[model samples]
Target: MDLPEIQSIDDLALLVEKLKLGLVSAATSDEYEFSDEEYKRIRKILLSNPMFTELIPSYLKLCRNLSGVWQYIKHEFSTYAERRGFHY
Candidate 1:
């Protein structure tokens, strides 16, 4: 499938939702884990994307909030089939 063009934070969030879903599915089906390289790639995608760049500050803040609990955050993303709420 063709990837959607990201041109706004909403678009980025939507893309992230898809990615999170994929990660969850992969974790179950293929035991996927984020490698350092893969993590770098994700960060690169977000920072390089024009739309995501516009919301970098908010993104950074979110990251800061989750810094100590990154493993928990990853586990949540990797297993949850649906996003339950907007606590993030």
Candidate 2:
């Protein structure tokens, strides 16, 4: 699948929706794993735009398959309250 360029929050929302659909489809088979390149691209985007960081937790809750990506985000933006909320 092609990763869309996320210039605005709407774009990110669409990407998240697409990912959720992909997860639903992949659930019938094996786990879904993002390619290394895709991972790097997403990481770069998040790093460059901290405004979109709030979406990480929502994505994690929707798809635990991407825990590694969540870990990276958690590490990069560790807030005690947010981490506690995620754990519980």
TM-score leader:
2
lDDT string, candidate 1, 20-85, tens digits: 544343334435444434434455566666755776545332442223224444555643433222
How big is the positional error of residue 20 in model 1, measured in Å on the Cα after superposition? Answer: 1.9
**lDDT scores in order:** 0.46, 0.49
Cα distance off (Å), candidate 2, residue 55:
5.3
Best by lDDT: 2
Candidate 2: stretches off by over 4 Å: 1-5, 17-29, 54-88
Score candidate 1 by lDDT: 0.46
Clashing pairs in 1: none
